[model samples]
Target: RLGELASLSYGLAMTVVAMKTVTPEPAESGALVARLETLSNAIERLPRVIPPRGKGEASAAPPPCDLQDQIAALTSQMEDVVAGGPIERREKAPEQAEKGEVKKKKGGFFVSGAFSDPAYSRFALKGTAAVMISYLTYTLLDWPGIHTAMLTCFIVSLTTVGETVQKLFLRIAGCLVGALLGIVSIVFILPDTTSITSLVVLVGLVTLPAAWIAVGKPTVSYIGFQIAFALYLCILQGAEPGFDLVVARDRVIGILFGDLVVYLIFTRIFPVSTLTQLRLDLDKLIRQCRDVVKTKAAFDPAAGAIQEAGRAYATLETASANLAAYGYETFHSGNRRLRAQANKLAIKALRGFVNALAVVAAFPPPQGDAEKSEALRQLLLHAEMNLQTLAFSLAAPFDVSSGALVDSMPPALSPDDEPSPQISALEALMARLNNVKMTLFHYRRLLHTEAGAYE
Candidate 1:
């Protein structure tokens, strides 16, 4: 009876896999071209913003009107910061400035007194959770061989560390549910090892619901493992002979223990996000912004920038969501400050993202006016560099000095500032952008202060 049931389940799953129907992923190609073209133009206009051959210390920001050299200096600083500029270490963290680093050393791990991620530290807490649970269960029930039963951590621990809780939890849930269902079938329906149709039916049943939920839910990859785990448990696990209920419970506990090990480990390992990945996401937005500009040379790039900004808003939201997941995983004392700073920067970046997009969108195509195009190009380059600096900051754990994270976006070219087939709507947009800079600045400061408080 069990053999026939298993065969039936497997057959149905094969059929589902044969049909490849999945939603289309968002495209990055359209935006890539736009980002490149705008960047090229920005490069050309850079000279106009800076004094061609001036040699001196860089100024903080551009003077509001026609101060091209001032713009250049600001632009250059933006680039340097993004490049990580040599880590001069001039500005101090507010806490360090107040309390001093030496006085605050309490149970902190350090490499040359610099706190960082360590694999052992990250997973240690998880091991505590697991071992405590196991020892307690063993002590209370005296499940035979409790002293020798599953005590060592798996080798997979090192590799799986740093995965999000959502993923870990989803897989854990799927594996547990799948394993139980599999065992139930093996015992009640698949008494024989050589059944085909019954197995197919089982596979199909599990896959159908797993696929649907994975597709519709936010974190879907776990569904992929759900049926796989179910198949493994149903067919293979039946060989393990023991008290049915206790054995199943122990397996569930073991799976959870493994996941917690990985989760705890990831949070602790000087778990820095890569600069390259951060670069990729920002580059994606930049490319999208450029694609809009490419539609028509005379067409203002502001509209495209606005669209790209919309994408960025989504990106930040995703980052924030990820941060929340990390927090829920396991508490690591060292990561506390880094998390505080990152959340602050993400919030600030979102505000800047909106303002920058709107400001760029309001620009006019210069009415066949080459000089105007050149000026707009200069602004775009500066804006892009500012974005790069923001991106770089988010990618690593480094101290930002006073005024480090703050940035003033490039001004939008006004309708009155151009001769053209006048568009009233575009001009009004420019006026609105004039006030946007200060608002964005305010938000950035909020994040900066929040980061400072924790640091």
Candidate 2:
């Protein structure tokens, strides 16, 4: 049955592909194209034919001749092309080979120049220094109880100072909450518990809420695990029931100490600002949007233009998420509030721009209307140019005098124009083009605003 269905699907797809490829001249063979369409539809409605499984089983019925008819029609249409000449294969370009080599060289993690960047090196050294400080504090001071300090450093370390600080805060909050719960269990619950069953019940009670929290959202989930960890340490110190406040105290101190060390080292020495990273991301997104616009202008069905658009959308999503984390960052050099406001405005504009681009891409200009196609192409070109300018502006320092703001309006159609489907699509694209301009204008304006201007 599956085989029959697969064959039918393949036949239908091939029929459709052939229908799209063959452009029958209205004066010459329009009737032939109509017949092919009818046959393609008939092929889709054909019944599935299951083959005989054994010698006694009945044989499957033969398929209809619609497929053969469609193939014959396609071949007849292509007869002129077949008679013209044999097709020639083009050789690969040297530039393309060089590009492929460059892509291959930059593909892996270790070879991606990650260690070459000073910021990455600083981040690495900072984390290593934090762990070493914790390790030495516990070992040299002969404080085995606070050995979890080293573990805490490993758990909370992150790439950026803002991210690391954010994780450290979560770790601290989770640790404190967990420690409190552990202490409470030790005081009230442990005294009443006699058997291992009662102790298990107590631990389970504390663990239930912690597990609930741990499984929650990423921002607050660490609190839940910390709650479980703190409670477990205080309750399950040994095989026998033991209530020692000192163990909980030591673990909590170790976690807090590690956090403090990380915080001071990451923030005070060679700190990587999230806001700076956000700017770079915003720049990359603008360039991606430009590429998307450029791809949409040409609009190739088989050249993976859709994949490029998908990647741009993905970058937009990542930039938005980083903006959210940007709020938690306090280590930026400039007027952090002003930078945040500008970024927020720019991101909102970018969101609208991307959405408008999606609409424009969806309603491509009709292929038969050369004038409308050219007009749409012009609009996309204007948008692409403006996007390129915006990206350049974002890469450098913002300049009020820079002419980043350019007119992005599409050419207006005449009021007395005929009401054709192609014209309507063009009109829709024109409206979206106006929206794109508005967003670009807003983004350009935000970038132009100086720090003092905000004050």
- Kindly give the number of clashing pairs for every candidate: 39, 0
Model 1, 210-309: lDDT tens digits are 6776676454555556646544544544444223554555555556655655454544544433222333554454444443334223344222333444
What TM-score against the true fold does each predicted structure earn? Answer: 0.42, 0.66
Model 2: CA > 4 A from native: 1-102, 106-111, 114-116, 193-221, 240-242, 331-344, 363-365, 401-408, 418-455
Candidate 1 wrongly placed segments (more than 4 Å):
1-167, 183-195, 213-218, 235-247, 260-368, 388-455
lDDT by residue for model 2 (150-250), tens:
88888888777667877888888888888888888888888888888887787787789889988987667888888888777777788777788998899
Q: List the residue pairs that clash in candidate 2.
A: none
Give the C-alpha lDDT of model 2. 0.61
**Top candidate (lDDT):** 2
Q: What is the C-alpha lDDT of each candidate?
A: 0.44, 0.61
Most accurate candidate by TM-score: 2
